[model samples]
Target: MTHFIRVLEFSNKEDALKNFCGSFRSGESDFGIFSVDASTFGSLPSSVFAYWMNPSVGDAFSRFRNFAERGLKAQVGCSTKDDFRFLRLWWELREPSDKWIDLAKGGRYSPFYSDIHLQINWKDNAAELEAAILKKYPYLGDSANWVLHRESDYLKPGITWTRRTKSDFSPRFLPAGCVFSEKGLSAFIDGGSRKDISAALAILSSKPCRSLIEVQLAAADKSQAGGVANSYEVGIIKSTPAPDTDAEVTERLAELACRAWKQKLTLDGIQESSHAFHLPAALRDRLGSFDPPAIEAELARIQAEIDAIAFDLYGFSEEDRAPAQASHAAARTDDEETDADDEGEDEENAALIDQTAGLLSWAVGVAFGHFDWRLATGERAAPPEPAPFDPLPAKSPGMLPDGAAPFHANAGILVDDQGHPHDLARLIEEVLARVEAPVPEDVRRWLQKDFFPFHLQRYSKSRRKAPIYWPLSTTSGSYTLWVYYPSLTSQTLYTAINDFVEPKLKEVGADVTALRNKAAARTRDDEKQFEALQAFELELIELRDTLLKLAPTYKPNHDDGVQISAAPLWPLFRHKPWQKVLKDTWAKLEKGDYDWAHLAMNYWPERVREKCKTDKSLAIAHGLEHLYVEPEAAPKKTRGRKKGE
Candidate 1:
């Protein structure tokens, strides 16, 4: 078997072992080579690798629950304004939604209530999901019994390492928290303190260590596609040497790793307040000042320093470092190949759009009173309450009158004190300003052209598309109404038309009439005026007809949501657009472009599949037909007793 030994590539082999000392001695070193082929190497006994590798809990569909952002109440994780959507909660039917509420567990005081943790069914019974998981994969045992107890495993003192069972990517070590390990990946639990974990990660990430691992894996038989020949079995990992238990070195390596990880959290815009350690004063003082490149450079610097430490631990001579250098160089070349990903535009643009979607969704919630006003607008001093049942005379001085709170419960941006809904554009502008992001140029044009398509792509997942906002429109693009999900009903369609479409049609009709009257009054041959008048008349006719076409969906006592099937809401903003809209949305969804499972269309798959024939296979591949739909049991048959009778 071919072995990719680091020493083979080194030009200078002398003086390599003079400065070397085995700290942990987890592996056997024969001569200058660390080979698993040696009899004693794989058998080197050690406790550092005694980890409880969690089992694969099947596909993400069965174990992962992602809440497409419904409202502020559905938001979860340590996400900050920048990466707010990094973690979103799965809606729980039992969670309170009638009044002011925060998604934070323990009502905002719990340290980790807002941070993302390993969770199943963010809005459902987690225990039930766990039970089902064990029932199907009983080999994982009743409790996934491993080398150590799992009583406080989530919060246990240890480092966590993740390796894809089938991917070619290098392993990654993350700060241990609540995370799920499914069939594709192996997670090593129970290392030591956060610092110890960092040290372990540093060693494993070193060039020599990675080279040794790659050789071993390549020598093993390839069992899966898109993966190396060998799995990162516990034996292979255990046989890799660990840095000697040097407290000072461990602490320094840990500091660098911890700092780098913290910077990453910051770069992603996760809320710093959610983490246990406060950012150094220097970093905190310059909040929002660091850019992506700067953060990346700092992280890279830390990694290089750790690599240097690993060299000393493994006693690699100057000549033996070529293999490690070559590996890094190859990684760099791969990155360069894909450097033109977005035509050299800022990748943050995508992040910004994603964040914009989140903000708009949050605003919709605030408008409908699904979320507390203070959560978005920031908390303010409370208004004084009225004295309860005081028997004071009306003439009493210095007494305040009984009054309501500053903000009404369930109040939204759509309507005002007079119960009149504002123009959709006006409400959106207010929401944009509240979130502090600039409204894209030509906000209406943006929505008409780009936003809906982007939104469809964002939520296009099987059994998961829960769009909280629905757009109702006529096929001709002659009229449109945007309605909040929580407030939608058949009556809402009628009310929106009455409030927006009907009034606009009347105003246009009056304009056309006046134009015709002026043209009639003018005796001179006014060719331009006649032409303009003709155009206005045509527009008025189309608008009136569009309104008529939409009226049926709002029939009284009808279940508009069920009957309409979002029919009046199509051709999305115009007729025949559904062909491209459904095609593009379904294609991207099938390709796994979107992250969450909340596409509004997924709820009614059969209707869409029947309506759009071209993308049927794509839809089916994503399991749309059976997703969120129950399977019918086979019909029971009874035998006929003809001869006996």
Candidate 2:
């Protein structure tokens, strides 16, 4: 005895189960079975009589009851014994479609108010059962309708039987060994409409149809059990045949070859290769004698046009230029010519003047020393008391003896009208008469040395020689008089002398009067100018003191090479150019030119005096050494031609 299982189709689980139970109650089955597998009633085995039900039918009943309880006004059946059996059959019946299976898997579907199940029995007459099913339900009788049968029935040989209903049932009509095996005890209830089931069975049994049909059953039992009567129709479909495997592979390989050719064509520089290998016949016919070099020349021409446009936008033009190139060429030419002339003249003149001034300075220094000695000791030595002399008077007509010439006098000095000397005190009285400042001793000495000695020398030189003859006057008998003839005519000499002397006298007298007026005015302007200079001197002293204080801390050797005294003071006053700066700053003072006076005063410390020794410009400007000092001898350098040849 082999144990087996089989699938059965039913209109619904409840209808199928009910039909099975009805057959058993009618004494139409001989299989000994006492229990059924179901969910509505408890599980049972042989000898324990019980009804089975599907769990889905029970769940549907509960849902119906719950909806009713929630005031939905839906119909819910009573749970009596009959109702319980009915639910069990419905649960056992096959569902019209497997769509219920989708519902069981938690997918959405049309609400299934019923459930179905398949029935299994140990042994039964399958042919008899089919006949009995048609007799009980006449819709199963059509040849076009499907009938459930065990596969083993057709496999048996030498057995033939005609189908019949339970009403015509006879023992002679029964097929021998028709009992359902456990493997063949399956049945199908109609799950489609009567008409659709008939058509479906017709199609299934046709020679061209590949599908197999089972059975069709009504859901009328479900309607009585408070379930929907309609059944879900379904078909198990098989797909059409596929192409041969080798043909598919060949097609794919062909496609792959075409794709590879396309990929090769997409590579850079492949066009030239493509043109060489795959030229069309028409293109080859038309391209005779065509030169690619000519095409390249045309492309080069187009590129040149673009380059020209770019150059025009950015490059320089002839108009946009500087004069530097032309000017530099001209300058070079001029420099050559100038340099040729300058070489001879410049060096000689520069050297000759420098040497002559140096010799004169040396002579003047010796003269100053001798004069200083004579002043210190009042002696007549071989030097013959070389006294310091004033500058020459321009009014003087003749030269003095070599020993007595004034220190600054030369033919050049005598020619200048402004260089005439007056009385020293009178000159001062004239110039500063309007000023209340006391005459400084150094200034008086400077004036006397610059002027008085020249005047005396001129007078002495003029009176030296006279006429030896005497002229007798009518009033006296033979009176002898020495006569002096002046260098100029009497009228000229008188006029020149008066002109030289009168203005100076007038200047002195007028200055005294102006002084009285100025004193009367008593403006604080003079005092302020004095005070300003004093303050400026104080500031300079403070600055110098500050530099000295900083000097010890600053090591010029180790630090930046700057000496404090070398720092210029002119910029501190914030004036114009240095010349105007000096003029404006010292103009308010009573001194004729305070700037020069101030410069002279500070002109020489030891270092500066030493520097003045080499600094010709400073020596000339400030009367350093030679300019201020008297010469020991007149310059012996001859100005006149030597003698008659």
Candidate 3:
């Protein structure tokens, strides 16, 4: 009884003669009929995974794809070989590190990082862009580029791609797959029964097939030491054996896989909703309620059920099932733990964050004249439509620094010379003051503490790097402040100084003087109140002086054209390069001694000088001028009390 199995490498032509002789010899022998070839089916090459190997320009090819806003599209929507992972399958578009130009669009070039590069809307610019890209990357003009270049027509309903090669040969399913892929990512697209293909996709995406792929395919490149470098060539992939296509079992597998894919899409949908600053009240309530966790738990259960079905289909034994079951269990644990961490006040906080974010959005709109005073009365028909590069209106009711009372004016006030509202600061203050508790107990405090954190969480999924309200601050975070999108304009700063800062200074000065008089009349019993007022007075004085000094330097220079911060234009649009800004701004803004100029100009030069001046002034005021220059002695060590003492 000669028992020999042939594991033929389907794509390797050199193995054909060897396979033929082995098969003939086996048939000639007594046990010839017992010989079986495990990999006689389709291989990976039978699938469609094309790479656009273009000329690598020195850094110039790196331009259009970047971590910043200068990318060809909103960002480089490509997937690299390293991006795909089991179950958590998705592509992360990246910015080009090397510089590239978009000649047609007056942009730079970028080497292919993903297979899916063309946009559905890029049809108008396709020929021009294609010509320019091919000129710079002539090699990309190969016939193979046809599929990708003509992707709009080919991008169908059920296309998918697999990682060409991976450390683990476990299949990664991309239901919402891209049009093209990098060299190591292979895609699958052909006409067939939708149900059959979906079932096959699920079976491939599941774990049982992973064990089969490893046993039949050739080892990939020996590049990484001590790591399994497995390859999934088209020939070998197609050669993977399976039950009959029309079998009842195959239908069941297809149904399970489709269900799992749908569940994954649900999670993606949830994440997409949270990406924007606002969440619908219904979604917010559901997320805060019992729905989200329940859905997550149910999804995990479904995946486990699929794993069991796959085991039976693959004829995996108890021992083989051990690893697969363990993998499924581990994944379930991770999902549950994630759910547990997100429970409790998470939903409430998310809802509150959304509400606060809406308020901030409204304020920005008002500041930019996109919104009118009707927002205050809750009579605004719809949120203001945002435009990135357009000039702001001279004065919407909420945006005016001063204005006349129009007919039916709810908050009666006279109009300015420009026929706008007077006292922009007053409107802002009133709007903020009227905000009820918990939505934001204190708007300023909320902005200073929580807004950035929430924004980070919201945009984390998209990996957006820019922020609408850029923060400028010192390295130490001891001084941080905000710059609204419009405020980045050279003109807005000038307007703000006269309309916003000057009036604020007057208000602070008035409060300081009132506090000073009260302190003068205070008795020993009122020391705490007197000290509190004095501290506040000092802060106000510093703010007043800072604004006064910045007045001359903050002149309008519309040509500087709002700096880099205004490029994103609106908060709703995607932004990047915001993380660093947010980090520095939050750090500085949290400190009591931080500068406000950092907000006006994205620089902080006066931080050290101001701190020195503050220390010197404080020392002189406290009659400790000498001590101020000297390092203080270490505090005396305090002894712990004995049990009785």
Model 3 bad stretches (over 4 Å): 1-154, 159-180, 183-186, 193-197, 216-239, 247-251, 265-293, 315-446, 461-464, 468-502, 509-645
RMSD to the true structure for each prediction, in A, is 15.5, 65.4, 21.4
- Candidate 2 lDDT over 287-345, as tens digits, reads 23333345345434432332233222222133211221222122223221212101111
Candidate 3 C-alpha lDDT tens digits along 145-218? 44234533222323233333223333333223123332223334344455655566566555655444433443
Shift of residue 537 alpha carbon in model 1, Å: 11
lDDT of 1 by residue, 1-645 (tens): 212233332346444433222411545444443223332222323311211111110111122221111000111121111111122222211122221112211111100011222122312222322333443455665553231122323322222232322222233333332432321122233424545555655566666665445444432212212222234543445544443538988888767655655555544332211222112212222233646577778877876887788767666667666655664444333322212111111112212445445444434444444433342333432223212111112211111113323222322124311223554444556655764545655555544555545544433221223333455554444345555554454466556556655665576567656657775565455556566545654654554466566555433111112112333344344424444454565465445443122332344445555432333223332344333333354577989899969
Q: Quick one: how many clashes does candidate 1 have?
A: 12
Tell me the spans in candidate 2 whose CA falls farther than 4 Å from its real position: 1-350, 354-525, 554-645
Query: After best superposition, candidate 2 residue 245: deviation in angstroms?
Result: 99
Off by over 4 Å in 1: 1-119, 122-179, 183-188, 219-239, 270-287, 331-441, 454-471, 483-495, 509-645
lDDT of every model, 2 decimals: 0.38, 0.23, 0.35
Best by lDDT: 1
Higher-lDDT candidate of 1 and 2: 1
By TM-score, the better pick of 2 and 3 is 3
